[model samples]
Target: MNNNLHIITADTVREILDQYPLELYEIIKNSYILHDQQGSINAPSSFLFFPHRPESRIIALPAAIKPNQEKFNEISGIKWIASYPNNKLKHMPRASAIIILNHPDTGFPMVCMEGSLISATRTALSGIVGAEYLYNKDKSCKSLGLVGNGFIAKHIVKYLFLLGWKIENIHLYDKFSSSVEDFRQYIQSFGDLKITIHDSVSTLIESCSLIAFTTTEKIPYLNDHNLFKHKPCILHISLRDISPDIILDSINVVDDSEHILAANTSVHLAYERNKKDASFITATIGQVVQQKQTIPKNKTIVYSPMGLGILDLSVSQFVYDKVKKQDLKNIENFFPS
Candidate 1:
């Protein structure tokens, strides 16, 4: 074993990504394209469930990037992340994680870094890029609704502002008013539009052509198909928010078919309900980005990405190289000879 392992803290990840949101967006785009070309290998994300604590789960996402991607080094890694829905009540984040990058050839673990920031950042940028291919700005940006105002929603909103997406208003619908207050103040720093907090998801759904679901719902609670009758563009950031029937009715696009199909997500439910008929999902974000597949203009478009592991690896590669040059802390003799 011949490798030194570097440790990247959340503050470091935040500091670096805050300065370069657009660059990270580009990295995610390239990664999707690389994935679309089949230049990457993404294994199914395995989960550690606490049956006693049904609301919490720890997920392990392992993936690799091939040398074909010119912008990033050929590397492989896994992000181990835990999500506890009640953590916010304890005044802590709901999700926490760390990513480990391995030497692509030697298979030595080269870096261990805080992953919650990277996970959220990559997740946000992926949603933005995924929606970029689907939504017509004039049509979809009517109000920009958010279902959950947790950390994920905050990152998505921040990138939307920093990346220069024009918006006239932002309508929010969250279970807790306390959650909205902090999110509302955060929006002020980025400049403001009409910030309305609707009393219900249905009202918010009716008000915006573009809506993002960022909740921690494990099961399908919103089964109302009529809510999306306006044919809105929904960035289903939280995978299991919509009901299976809704998934069946809408035109869906996921990051990867194999990955999302098995996760018991809405689409997965639809897939099972319809007896393995996956015609409802029109394309992966990769195919959409490559212009190989096109989505119809007059239907509800649900871009439900199950948070591909390959994405984490790609962004981790970029972050590792950037911070590797800086004087960050590292674990010496990490790989024993």
Candidate 2:
């Protein structure tokens, strides 16, 4: 079999997002198997950490096997996607990653691809998927309140726009006014989107039917108003962005309970600290989309994505294939033995 490595850039991802739908679905499908490992430190000032360090790495490890052979043809592959944001300010990129595609049989490296866009797009599409399953297609949703304006928020807005969700009103509240203003200008380039700067998060949450918490905040700074009960909204809690009380009050759906619980990062930590059972997790977003389970419309639904490796691998696989077709490459050898 012909083997080669590929290097994919941020622009490559934009092209992928622009053209391929089937490949996108495949990536989302495979992402289900990977896991998330967000954690924290007790050091001075305290910090949240998602070390792609060792063990618990959810390697996609894809392969092909011969029918009658005792051993199968194996390929080497490992994907690592991780991120950390301290405050809503400082212009921090949410996630950075390195995806290793290798020869499994020979234990040699194959290719390396840029994972930032893959990570961002896969994550943003998740929110789109959430909107698909949770909200009725006929329902009119014009106003959206985004709690934090960060890297992830940009993509979420993009997907929402792509889905034909004529976002007539955009409400934003970030700790830094500059970030929020910058995001508004970036998204405004898409079209004549009505943008409103919320002096307070509470005002924004109350005004819009849909809400997204794409912040690095440790807790929800909003009032007691449970907006989830009002309409089918998305709480895309990337970090510990919302409060434990909010989590308990809302309908909790996640990418993977096992992965989230294992990592004990973000909202998962709140549940872990409160000694909540994993069974309490209402549903996995895929299962809901696939109709494995049903969630009530009356409840506020929050989808916590752990940013699994399968997502990185799935998108990286696409980049690898695209690079091969164009004859662009990054060489990494497998089976050094």
Best by lDDT: 1
Candidate 2 residue lDDT tens string, 1-337:
5454556666665686667754575456434422221111111111234365321122232322212322212233554544445322345665666667666455546667666677677777766666666665553467888887878888888766665666678889998888898899988988987889999877787787777777655444443645444654765655456666666667778876666664435456657656876655788876776677898867677677655445555566666677667756555543232
- Give the residue spans of candidate 2 off by over 4 A: 1-5, 21-26, 29-76, 81-94, 138-140, 219-232, 262-267, 332-337
The per-candidate count of clashes, in order, stands at 0, 7
Each model's C-alpha lDDT?
Answer: 0.87, 0.62
Q: Candidate 2 local accuracy as lDDT?
A: 0.62
The stretch of ten residues in a row with the least summed lDDT in candidate 1 is 134-143
Q: How do the predictions measure up, each by TM-score?
A: 0.97, 0.77
Best candidate, TM-score:
1
Per residue, candidate 1 scores C-alpha lDDT tens digits across 1-337 of 5557788898888888888888899889888888888888898899898889999999999998888566767888899999998898899989999999988788888889999999999999988986678986332365899999989999998888788788888998899898888888887778656899888999999999888999988888888878889999999999899999988988999998888887678889989999998888899998998889988977899999998888898888778778878996878887666
